[model samples]
Target: MMADLREMYTFEFMRYALTVGVFGGGMLAFLGIFVHLRRIVFLGAALPQITALGIALAIALHLPLLVGAVLGGLVGILLLSTSGKPGHLPTEGWVGLAYASGGSLAIVVLALSPHPDAGALRFFTGDVLGTNRAEALFAIAVAGFTALIFRLCWSKFVVSSFDPVMSQTLGLKVRRWNALLFLCLGFGLAAVMNSAGSMLAFGMLIGPPAAALMCFRAFPKVVVTTVVLGAGAAFVGLTASFLFDLPGGPTMATAALAPVLPAWIYRKIRK
Candidate 1:
């Protein structure tokens, strides 16, 4: 179990890759609680595609790729929160539009190139084994930011999640918090996409959190459980990919799903 990871740590690139995956896993697990509670599952796919379009546009314009991804995700976030208002469509419809348009743009841009697979893999699946030291430092910073956000809104976010109306009655500014949640989610989404690629980020964002919530009964317990499950999955997936010559993103998702299996089986037996 530890051999692959130990070997991975000896190399500078693999060390960073594992570091990024760990921080990325923790961050996603943290934010995913809010995402799931808010009933915003589609944000996983929508935000990533929007960032992918940003990457494509950056390639087209020769600007900073990360900037394009962040800006694109922010635009999508704005549309998600404010679209279909003032005599326009609904937020759901707006999200659908952005999802399609951004994903389409990315696909088109990638297809126009001579070799699309490598580019697609790098942008969507992530190169976890080849991550650099700088990227690892960036991941740590992002993880710290995630921790800060969670600390600031620990109580309010929990109250709002369980009962928005009661929170509002208590002068909790639920709407403002919800908006702020979306903004933090936007930043989290952007950060993970750059570090882990869209698919790994999306899976790690939802999968381990979902699994942990299914296992734990209390809020604080759920947070610890989710983070543990998420980081564990990342470690397992990284090792599996390295040993089996598998891709990083899908393997990480598979590892995440591993923890959910026992619960699912028990549910089936009870049913």
Candidate 2:
């Protein structure tokens, strides 16, 4: 059974896949807790596809795709800034328009760009089995950043998460903190993009924390369970991708959903 998925690492891309599965899983597992709790999972959710547009544009224009993605994320942040929610800069209506525009812009760019190929397909589809040493190092850096932030600002983030007004009243720069959190999520989204591609990246952003929150009894448990589920999903998904010769990123994402779906269905049934 295991031989069906014997990884052939003679090719470089396969290493990148597994590398991403491990390191990307680590970073995202940590980040998922915040996005899940804050209900802003969509930053991870929507931005990667938008980033793909930027990458496609860069391809056509002969620029670096990664730089294009960072630019795209910056554009997303700019759009969000104008989104009003109380102290938020943009109104709900404005945010909706922003999302619509972002998605539409990506489609237009893809349609206009030249030289679309499997290479480009990797962006939307994911290439988990293709992990390389450099990408793995990148993943480690992202994971390190996430861990550092979580350790240094866990309490502040938690207070703001559950009760923002009180957190602010205590002299925390509430608005600035929220913006910083979103920025972290954006950086995270960009970092994890290659590991899981678009939707898989979105799944990593949402799945583990969601599963942990549902299964665990306490906040601390949420953290532990989230990381565990994230790693488990990545391992299982990568294995599945190997067996089926499927795209690693989406397979990992679909596998990530495996735990969540049954739990969600069970919750609904019990209700």
Candidate 3:
């Protein structure tokens, strides 16, 4: 098994894919804690579709995929963040619209692109094994930056997130913190969606943190466990996919979600 593993990673592409899987999965899982805490899981789902739309637009316009993804994610954040205000449609309604339209539009735009790349389908279907060195490095950089920011502003972020009114009373700049958090979410989603596709991006964002939160109440332990599970799922899923000749992205997503049921059962038993 060890020799086979070594042989599999002897190719640079496999190493690059693994790097993206680990770092991208870990980062999305970490950010997912905030998504869960804020009860914005729908928003998380919508953003990936929006990011895909951006990728399709970039392909159509011959722009950078990262640039399009970032813009698309940010636009989704801006639109969805303000949707909680009193309106005819509930926030969920608007989020659902974005989710539906964004995905449909991406496919339409991609279909219309005059210069579509042969691998363009991979953007939606996922092609993690095709990841390049630059994409792997970008994943690492984004993950490191996210960790560093949260490390420096842990208390502020936590306080602002869970208790906005109290955060305002304490003059913690709640709005600024919230915006920063959304910015990080948008950036991270864009990066992950660009490389791993929307399925892996959304799966990693929701799965590990959901399981970790089910098992533990301590934020620090939850964070650690979530990252570990996410990265471990990526490794396990990629290896399984390789060995079984299955699809890599969906395999990783399934692995990421595998812990949820066990954790839920554990919680029920403890209670």
Candidate 4:
């Protein structure tokens, strides 16, 4: 098995896929902690769909797909944030609405396009194995940016998430912090959805963090464990896909669940 794995990485495409999966998976898992802790898992599901819609639109308009994706994700984030306030549509409702709308819009856009299969549509579902060096670099850059933001505002983000009132009491701009966090989430989703597809990206965003929460209570430990598990899942899943000739994105997503189920069951039994 080790020999096969080593031989597989001899190819440039395999190396690129592995690099993307590791960095992209780690970034998704790191951001997922906020989604899980804030009880906003729906965003994990919704934003990616919105980004897919953007990719479809970009294809139709002959624009850069990444630009379309980021714009679409940002629009979704803005809409959700605006309507998600108290005395408005609840966050889950907004997220559900966005998900459905985005999926429908993507289908409509593709159906109306002159060339539906212009190859960009693969991003909607994912094409992780097709990732090139440039996309991998973009993924790395986004991950680095996310890490910097988290490092600088770690306490503010945690405080804003756990206690908005406390954040305000401490003279923090709660809304600003929340917006920054959501922006980072949107950026990460857009960056990965192109390579990993919306579905796999969403899985990475939720699965590892969920598993980590089951295994640890300390915030730092949970964050570190989530990153490790996500990266590991991506690596294993990519290897399996190469060996079995399976779809890379879904394989990785399914692999991410491997550790989660056992950890969840253990936590339940302990409880």
Best by lDDT: 3
Put down candidate 1 lDDT per residue, 152-223, tens digits, no spaces.
878887888779999988888987877767666666666666656777778877888787777666888889
Candidate 4 minimal-lDDT segment of 10 residues: 115-124
Write the residue-wise lDDT of candidate 4 on 2-32 in tens digits: 8988899999988888887888888988999
- What C-alpha lDDT values do all the predictions have? 0.74, 0.68, 0.91, 0.86
After the best TM-score superposition of candidate 3, give how far the Cα of residue 234 lies from its true spot, in angstroms.
0.9
In model 4, the clashing pairs are none
- Best-to-worst order by lDDT is 3, 4, 1, 2
Full-model lDDT, candidate 3 = 0.91
Q: How many backbone overlaps does candidate 3 show?
A: 0
At residue 8, what lDDT does model 1 achieve?
Answer: 65
Model 1 steric clash pairs:
84-89
lDDT of 3 by residue, 1-271 (tens): 9999999989898888889899989999999999999999999999999999998998889997888888999999999888867857899999999999999999999999997888776768877887888788888888898899999999999999999998899889998989989998998888778877999999999999999999999988999999999999999989998999988888888999999999999999999
Q: Estimate the lDDT of model 2.
A: 0.68
**Candidate 4 deviant stretches above 4 angstroms:** 85-87
**Candidate 3: RMSD over Cα atoms?**
1.0
At residue 123, candidate 2 shows an lDDT of 66
